[model samples]
Target: MTHADTPAVQGGPELAQERRLVTEIPGPRSRELAARKDAAVTRAVGTMLPVYTVAAGGGVVVDVDGNSLIDLGSGIAVTTVGNANPCVSAAVAEQAAAFTHTCFMITPYDGYVRVAEELARLTPGQHEKRSALFNSGAEAVENAVKIARAHTKRQAVVAFDHAYHGRTNLTMALTAKNMPYKHGFGPFAAEVYRAPMSYPFRDAGVDGPAAARRAIDVIEKQVGATNLAAVVIEPIQGEGGFVEPAPGFLPALLDWCRANDVVFIADEVQTGFARTGDMFACDHEGVVPDLIVTAKGIAGGLPLAAVTGRAEIMDAPHVGGLGGTYGGNPIACAAALAVIETIETDGLVDRARAIGKTMLDRLTALQADDPRVGDVRGRGAMVAVELVQAGTTEPDAALTARIAAAAHAQGLVVLTCGTWGNVLRFLPPLTIPDHLLAEAFDLLAQIIKES
Candidate 1:
């Protein structure tokens, strides 16, 4: 069936799923809302586009200005199943009407257990697994570290360069970039070490296993395996320019972790669910992580995250350990269950791979024509275009910003990432129409030409 015939485009949530510009990009209503936001909300929280979304579904975000922009970011890869997905929406409504928050630790419900069961069945590997839910990716990641430390009786952790875990105190420490995420957030948690990552574009001389050896040498020499509790990595670095590690990098790292008894934590927060072509990015290399941190696209658009790992490792924490009041809220858990259903029933994993092919083919063509386009990388819907100066590897962050801004003005919701801020990341929802996808790229190509 064509995109126009899909349920999302066929009028769920009254969204047209087509890019429409009734007014200028931000328009007047969005500006008014932005003014109110500036006055009421903290300036610390930054918004990518000041358009002020009113409704979003499929591949289009309808702003208060009566403009619909094609979504390429997916709220930084959160709304994979699409914003206001019917299944997730209905499930959330039903659960909300039943009862909202009871605090899982206090009055546990079936929804939480159901989500855990589904996670065990879905995540990579058939080995006995357990799950703990949380409100955000950061919370899930932090708890994963806690569980790893508890299980291994070690304190030190290693995070890769250009990685972005979250904005919490512990996650900030885990994050590599210094400007926005960690600029003023000083005196971060200690015992967190940095390691080299395999960047195929930059480190062309080295392959995957060789790169793993580089990071392993640093970890063993500096942090020491005995002192390390976990080695945290984004299987495909999301904020780190969607950097996919070299071929054998992850498998080799998993081997080292297995040998050293170090908990290998895959932060699949951005790459989890059906965002990647595989059920999980770890599946690409058949590298099963000891602990997997998941969020972003977990519950459609609802706030829910989880740390799933081996039953033994997950059970190491004490009786009163792991969980929060809002963690695994009934409504969120219900949404998560519905999301899993949508992913399976809708066959979104294959859809994600298809979307990847469309994007990669288009981007690869653009790279071939433009020398400024340094690299086109990522798997599935999680893809990125790294910008660089012609004839050199030096990042062209300014040019990237101009391209994103131009795309935004033309009703294309593009996002920028990377440690150097020179990457344009595309994370279109799986439900996005092929026409809209093509248009988004065409617009991007035109904007690049103009720039």
Candidate 2:
């Protein structure tokens, strides 16, 4: 049978897997909607591509302008089961028809319990675990911090450089970016410390173990383990450009956390599910976090996030100390359950590894010929290229933006990110067709070369 016949195939054979542009990038209808959006929507809200989407399945997004573009962003890595996944959609419809939200904090539902059980089973470590659901990655992250502080009786939380936790007040403090995510937005939460991350691309000769030492030194001298409650990080840093930590860095950091009683929280919001080839990125290093903040791919595009970890740590938060009115809404829980099933039954974990191999091979080859391509790094479907001034590691944000814009114009949706904003990240849904990925990469390579 063809790949499309497998459970791993996105949407189905009926969905168009090709990119077709009948008009300019933003056709008249999308332009009209854009004008409407300018009038009705807040200016602060931004879009990567201005085209208005109508339907998306498999690897293609159909826009209102009748143009179909290859979706490489996966709505910022949320639709791992693919947009409108059949299983998830069916579950959501069934749950929504029965009941939407009774508030798990008020009248708990079985779906929430089921999702929590699944989370406990899937997250790293075979220990007894517990999970709390929330509405966003930021909520899960904030809740994780609360749980850590409650357990350790410490107030300071350490986040790494080049990390993008979220936009909430606490998560914004956790995040490292400034221009768009943090500029003028805070008076951020205090007692949040920044530590050096293992950016092998920028930090010369710093391997994983050595990088861990550097971060540990900073936390010891600057924050002190006594005052630190947690060291939160994205195993494969997401918005900060799919920056995968050095091999030994995470395990070493976890060891230090255990020794000093600091909670090691892995923010796998973007890398969890099957996006990183492994169910969770922490699985790569056999590092089990004290708490893992998960979202994005959790509910197959629905708004859901979770913090799953050891039972003792998760139970530290007092009753009613960790829930929200809409946390673990019934419908979202149903969706999450379906998404987990899809990942398992479809063998998306292996699919992610295959996609990663293809992406790494293609990007690595491109890097061999282009000095401006400073680095090609990532795991599974979470991959990226860091653009730099030729022969130097200096960021080329302008060039990156130009290439992204060119790709968009040519009916391919690509996203750029990084601390210096020179990284082009590719987060295609695990369900994306191989040919679609190859097509998008070809367009991207051409744009990069032309630029």
Off by over 4 Å in 2: 1-13
Worst window of 10 by summed lDDT in candidate 1: 1-10
TM-scores vs. true structure, each candidate: 0.97, 0.97
Give the per-residue Cα lDDT of candidate 2 at 227. 99
Candidate 1 residue 2 C-alpha distance from true site, Å: 39
Please give the lDDT score for candidate 1.
Answer: 0.91
Model 2 Cα lDDT, one tens digit per residue, 268-329: 99999989899999999899998999999999989999999999999998888989998888
Candidate 2 colliding pairs, count? 0
C-alpha RMSD for every candidate: 4.3, 4.7
